[model samples]
Target: MSAESDYVTLISSDGYSFVVQRSSACISAAIRRMLDPSLGFAESKTNTCRFENINGLVLEKVCEYFYYNEKHKNSKDVPDMDVPAELCLELLMAADYLNV
Candidate 1:
């Protein structure tokens, strides 16, 4: 498995949680590191990410992508064209938000 801090948490709309690589999370061009200079007790324990815009179903699919990438960690495989229409849109939105 990858190093721990190398990953971050992603919470789905229904409050489901998934772990994603910090590098992958950086895919979101708009995301900025937390601006706070000091570490507050709350921030340390709740590193889990909160994504308010995406619903549960979409998030499930995004998690699938993350897992898929993990499997292809060494290969430059092209994105499979078999994604469902709804999922495609959701993934796009999620990717856009994460700036992947």
Candidate 2:
């Protein structure tokens, strides 16, 4: 795992597991702080990332985006891919989660 912490378990609405590293999970600032705070970081009761408004396919797209970003954090030479509408929604959700 490329993350700096333990593996995180993101659970989907229909009972799906999205295992991700702390670094990859940090892609969403919301979950980052909530799950692993800089100070007073504690274990959360949640074992999942509970996307109440997002569907499976869209969440999958968001996970794909996270993977891509994590895989190419140092490479600025990559070209942009055509983003789907659902992905836009997922990004919005991420922004909302991060409260940015």
Candidate 3:
């Protein structure tokens, strides 16, 4: 894949855009499917994904989790990510939806 295809843009409901590594984002099965080239999804073509139900703040956390997951995939004693208590529910819902 070209350098351009190595990253993807994720847009949130509240109009935030995060440019993240495609491999990192693929930690979420749902996102992998959305950006699968063979699947021919519009998101795959554009390398952009829009989450209508997820706000910017939550989406930002999700993206962080993506990288965190990728970084720890082959390691032991991983550190826990800091999450605000207020975002727990929404993060849980987003995780379920994303099949992370």
Candidate 4:
């Protein structure tokens, strides 16, 4: 696969498209299964997963956490990820949806 194929685009409910690394996205079990070819979903064929219930902002945060998790996955020290106060509840809901 070429460098561009190493990533996938996740489209949020509001039509925001986020291109994230496939390896990074696998950090979330839900996403992994959805994107897995064995499952035979449209996402696996197109490398594009759509979340109609997840808004763009929540999806963006989840993607950010995925990358952050990867950066600290093998490290002893993990930096803090600060979520804005107002977004805490929404972030939690998104986390639940992502099974992260």
lDDT of 1 by residue, 8-97 (tens): 677777898777766655444433343111433232345556778987777767666666666666878667735788577778878777
TM-score, model 3 to reference: 0.93
lDDT by residue for model 3 (1-100), tens: 3323888999999999999999999889999999988888888888999999999999999999988888899898999999999999999999999998
Q: Identify the runs in model 4 with alpha carbons over 4 angstroms from their true place.
A: 1-4
Q: What C-alpha lDDT, on a 0 to 100 scale, does residue 54 get in candidate 1?
A: 85
Report clash pairs, candidate 2. Answer: 3-23, 11-48, 11-49
TM-score of each predicted structure versus truth: 0.60, 0.67, 0.93, 0.90
lDDT of 3 at 33: 93
* TM-score computed on alpha carbons, candidate 4: 0.90
- List per-candidate RMSD values in Å: 5.0, 4.2, 2.0, 2.4
Q: Which candidate achieves the best TM-score against the true structure? A: 3
- How far residue 52's Cα lies from its native spot in candidate 1, in Å, is 0.5
Residue 20 lDDT, candidate 4, scale 0-100: 97
What do the candidate models score in CA lDDT, each in turn?
Answer: 0.61, 0.63, 0.92, 0.86
lDDT of 2 at 74: 95
